[model samples]
Target: MTTKLDGNCLALDTVSLSRRNKLILDRISCQLYPGEVLGILGANGAGKSTLLNVLSGELPADAGRVLLDGVVIHDMSVGELARRRTVLPQQAGLAFNLAVREVVAMGAYPFPELSARDVASAIKAALQCAEVAHLAERRYPELSGGEQQRVQFARVLVQALIARNPGEARYLLLDEPTASLDPRHQHGLLGAAAMLAKQEQLGVAVVLHDVNLAATYCNRIVLLAAGQLVAQGIPAEVLQSGYLRQTYQLDSQVIAHPQHPERPLVLFA
Candidate 1:
């Protein structure tokens, strides 16, 4: 599978950030390969979401650099960044009442400016991929929490792939992507992302709460606790009970899964 990214590439170089004198990240450095899934795992305030924001270009790094491939991400204008990256924040907002199709169409607003024909086709594709095409005309605010989240996913997918190219790399950042999803759809979307990364060769990073889900879908998992890298590597190496207890302050157990070998169950300790 192709793993090369467009322009230089995406990387974090000793990046640090703070808010109101509170340090959120402490010189964290990491790289993501093409067709690789990187899971940022941490507790509620462990800086998982902040790291995602820094990588996604939504928030600036306070004392370090973020490079896209080889180009410093800070150098790119917002429009330029839009051409290469997509981030699905914890809650994508909706001020104006809009239909699902209209919401999905907003993703295309950044590129090539999808025409009426293009919007219709692209929205259809995104909805189908997100399994919400049947609810295309439904109002966004009126949908169930899970359905709205799916619709948001549709929008995010549309934005990321509207003008995709094999020559140019694309990065997808999701914050707790399955937070509102039911068990089944949660599995579906995470499964879909893994396939997209390993099979279709997309670079993906997501903040996840469920250790089993991350182990199953991600190629590598990075753990943070109080703004430090406590663990990172293949699932087996990084998912020990001691690590879980220390990082999340929770009693949990890990065991191999019957269906997915790489992913394991996070049993109650």
Candidate 2:
């Protein structure tokens, strides 16, 4: 079961955002509680990635703010934010030549200096978490697409969970995290994220085009259409057949999963 709390939350406050002279997000506002997995759902060009950028502090909000426990997201220093949140953007490219172990250990780069032992421990932990421990010694660019994705995810998992002191806020934002992976790897990545959210109570937000996976794993769903929030609530509420049909302009049916009621099965109309 997920814990519900009003405090220790992350929120976007009336944020009006755009990119490259094009307006994308318009007056958006929402709150994410600890241990809650908020999955962002939308069709192509629905401003999902833009919203993630705004929340991740990658791009500045034009009219509002991002808050961590009522503190602005950008107000905190980069190192401080790095210690608190981790974002995994799908299809990340590495222009530089770095070994897999070196890439994974970079997650702990928020601190100035690390003992050799700490670096080794952190890389090992990240590799294990990402299920790429065997690839630790490989060259990052030589890895397969799926392997590289897992490696990047390992980096994210490491940084996000490295500092586990009590009362510290944490976040993981993924844009199409499972798009390139096969079915097995998709489950593996999502399973790892779900474990982090449920066991560690991390605040995770993922932008997923796969509605079924979003319903199956996320604690809450946020639906966007043409850069606007049309729905925000539990999977059952936000993934309603009517909402799906209206938002996506397609016919669909919603049914409960036999194993987990929180998981919704979508069928075409």
Candidate 3:
């Protein structure tokens, strides 16, 4: 069961937002608890990315609040927020032609307390975790789309690792991180994220387009449709046929996975 909201999580309490006078996010409420991945799923234009932005404090809500450790996120200074959370947007725009290691090193900027040795160690660990160690010498602009995405993931992983305060809970907010990745790297990326959550006790909130991927990796899933939260719960409880149809406008049979019986596998008609 989902834990009750307390002073230990990043959460949205009846958050809402509007863009260009059109409602982009309705009263969506959810939490990213430490040590678990929270997956956001929906059809295109369903406000999946917008919800992630709100959680990351990139976009302010029109009517409610985002809290981190039960404190208003808006009240935290930019550096204070960076010390505890790292966000990987849908696309990272870098105009420079820096090498891969240089890009990952950017994550260290938020924590000035990290020494040179500490920064180097954090970069190495992040590259290995994101599976981009071999691309360390490659030019950032020269890598393929998938490779670039993994590099960006490495960058954010660096931010998550070398926080100024090690005891405080950290968060990784990803928006469609695997969209450019192939099947192998897609699973690899999500698997790495899940492992980090388990090992580091980091809270991970990822926006994903694939239902099976969400069921496989996320501890909990949040479904959004047209700016409204359709459902949020454990995968077995929320990835039901009715919710799937209501959110995606599709028919599907929900079944236990052959290899992992606890996870739901959706077979769309």
Which candidate has the top score in TM-score? 3
lDDT of 1 by residue, 1-269 (tens): 33343444578778898889998999998767668889999999999999998998788998888889788888899998987788888867676688988888888877765577876787788899899989998888888888988888888888777767766678888899899999999998888777776654568898999888888778888999988888878788888888888789989878888876767667856
Per-candidate TM-scores read 0.92, 0.92, 0.96
**C-alpha lDDT (0 to 100) for residue 248 of candidate 3:** 99
| lDDT of predicted model 2 | 0.83
Residue lDDT tens for model 2, 5-110: 2368778888887778877887888877668788998888989999998888888899987887778878898878887778898698887778998888878787
> Best candidate per lDDT, number?
3
What clash pairs does model 1 have?
Answer: 6-169, 8-69, 8-70, 9-68, 9-69, 9-70, 10-69
Mark the 10 consecutive residues where model 2 has the least summed lDDT: 1-10
* Candidate 3, superposed: residue stretches over 4 Å from native: 1-4, 164-166
Clash number for model 1? 7
Query: In each prediction, how many residue pairs overlap at the backbone (N, C-alpha, C within less than 3 A)?
Result: 7, 0, 0
**lDDT scores in order:** 0.82, 0.83, 0.92
Runs with alpha carbons beyond 4 Å of true place in candidate 2:
1-6, 19-22
What is the TM-score of candidate 2? 0.92
The better-scoring model by lDDT among 1 and 3 is 3
